[model samples]
Target chain A: MRRVSLLAMVVVAAPVFAGAVADLPSGRFAPLYGLDVGQTSFPVRAFRLDVRPVSRADFAAFLSEVPRWRQGAVPPALADARYLATFAASKNPAAPVTEVSYFAARAYCSWRHGRLPTTLEWEYAAAADETRRDASQDGDFVQRILDWYGQPAREGDLDGPGSPRNVYGVEALHGLVWEWTEDFNALFVTGDNRQDGDISKRFLCGAGATGSARREDYAAFMRYAMRSSLEARSVLPRLGFRCAYDDVGRSP
Target chain B: MRQLAFALCLVSLSAAAQGEPRSVLALETRWRTESGEQVSLSARKGRWYALSFVYTSCAGTCPLTTQKLKRLDATLAKAGKPLDVVVVSLDPEHDTPEAVKAYRARHQLTSAKRWSILVGEQEQLRTLTMLLDFKYSKNPESGVIMHDNAVFLVSPSGEVKATMSSLDGPLDEFVAAVPAPTKGS
Candidate 1:
């Protein structure tokens, strides 16, 4: 019985220690907000990212493992009401989970021995267009992404994993749902950018305080704006998340 | 035997007393102090403290925040409250133990036991910040982090009582939130 229990422990512990992830090599990609006037293509460290957004089923497992994270069990400081309501109501565990706050999403990722991808990592992965690594300039790809943004988020589960893989073999970069990055709060826009006088000034300061690196990229601009508008505890109807990891031999 | 049983019952009763929830105090999480000590926030219980997020090298709102905290420290000292202050570095990659010490000395926070300047690995720092509901973002290009400027007032029991955006504003709420000095002192 002792040996059997020990074997069971390792079987359960293996996945917790070695999370499900896909490795991406070290690369460079220009982010929407970080570029200076002339600079482009900032370097990204090699990392592992989840191939798909966390599904309703995946989140249900997390709730079982960490009971404090369930919609009613969570503190108001970490997640507001309406969290995971759609997934709970639909009872369809296969759909991608939505209405998760940054705190809850982050907690879920942490429980899986992973963390949310930084915006740079998320954007860099999204820049791929099924065949090429940098597809920001691809008119058709950009248009398809922009068009998806126009559609209103509907109820019920969308597609499950492994459907829309990118060039990097990572799935569901766009046309599925908006994801929460680890640095969701870091995308700072000056008060002038928000066009709301004096509010942004109260909290933000410093250089590059002006407009985006490329003002023409309205799609990227909208992403940044959405990120900036969120507080840590605010859960949305459509926003969900996945996880990332530092490369195995690299010190985090 | 009777006294020991009564003490055990008292301990369990106190544990059940959830009147003040220290929701943010994940005492198990480890952190590095400015003076290079490794301690948990739970270790600092039994005194009221104020907590804020800052980066030592920040050129923006962080310096403004530090200045405001310095003034609040002095104000509290004069008022006989002499509250504890904790400033955790949002940019932990750059704010090393030695650097955090230098920043503390530079700010002239003399009370070592009261003024705690802390830095931790990114994950631990994130855990604390999430509990405090403080949000921050670092730009890899400019190396500047855009973050929340909220300061929190915590009770002696480790519960966060109130949060203020800027110390430059009216401090009535902050003063009220401050716990009165204990009976002896």
Candidate 2:
């Protein structure tokens, strides 16, 4: 067997987002954004939001419209109809679709005239706070996130479009299913390879101790450890993705 | 701010403990191989092992991974050397010994002395996988197993030496890396 070095130059395009809506406060418990190694804040204009997660009904429509999406037509590994959670059986057509791979999700996003959100764009949206945090200090931005997560999701669930504004006016950041990012290797915290090293540099939303934070925090370490264990291919039922479109003027 | 700091401390301690390899954490407490035998990393010490985590009902890369392992086994046999192939089931509740036996036969894994399929409690599987940095999650609605697809090669001392694409293409590199047993064994 040939030993091919796992080293390949990962050419990642910058995340597409609109202009800096506001410089929000960092989450109290979360790591400060842009503190990570090799962190590059992409031009915000490239990302157009898909406010909600893709639903079962949405994918069913896709399957019907796209011949390649039919069972047995796509990659054999992904050809199972069971991949799409049936809305009729669950009676929750609005629930995020489950059992789909990053590959399948990417295909769906491409078919829908959009692309998956990059890790930077996803974290910025989740951590952004328009009112209390965005208007105040970066610490306040972090505090708002802590406050949001502190309360029961059902109680604090923001409704309507403008109820709770993020830096970019996006809402429902934390409560939604873990969104898929376009850069699969974007958040590597620790490991043997340079690819892993590069990911750690983009640590924006994950809980971890930066050079500024006290290094002895146990909770921060656990969060970072869990983050490090993640691989691009691992998918969970609770994991769903939102689409992003390159704003007409900003796409490269 | 004080409370947040304290919480962060607790998280870091737990994460640090998890990151450090807990040598005393026994694998036997967590899982058993397909032969209904308890498995422990310590038990397999002093031999190079190929490890893959899979479930029985997988219609995707799991079967392909198994076939790849079998091909690696054949290559090893041809070289007059033998290697240990350990397939740890990610779906322990459904992948019972009987189910594994059937899977083994279906895959024509008749040469059992060199290969072993193992399943154990979910907690044990989780612990072992975490130690190896293998990520897996169960889909609650469909009960499907979602996991990373990399095979680990463990050194004779039971530490992971390298991770490879699959068992087939990287067979020779892995075989070369394993330390040959001492004479008069």
Best by TM-score: 1
True contacts kept of 2: 0.00
The number of the candidate with the highest DockQ is: 1
State the lDDT of candidate 2 residue by residue for A1-252, as single tens digits: 010110011012112222122222223223322233343222343356665666655665565556565444544223223443332344344456554545567678878777776554565455445543223235554444455333333521222222254555565555544556664332333322212222442343244455523244332233343334333333444456667776543432
Candidate 1 per-residue lDDT over residues A210-242, each given as its tens digit? 456654454565565556556566676667888
The collision pairs in model 1 are A186-B137
Off by over 4 Å in 1: A1-20, A36-38, A160-163, A191-210, A248-252, B1-23, B26-28, B59-61, B157-159, B165-173
Please, what are the lDDT tens digits per residue for candidate 2 over residues B4-120? 444534433432222233221222334576666666767777777788877888876688788878877787767766678888888888998888988888898866677888787
Taken over the whole model, the C-alpha lDDT of each candidate is 0.68, 0.53
Report the alpha-carbon TM-score of model 2 versus the true structure. Answer: 0.42
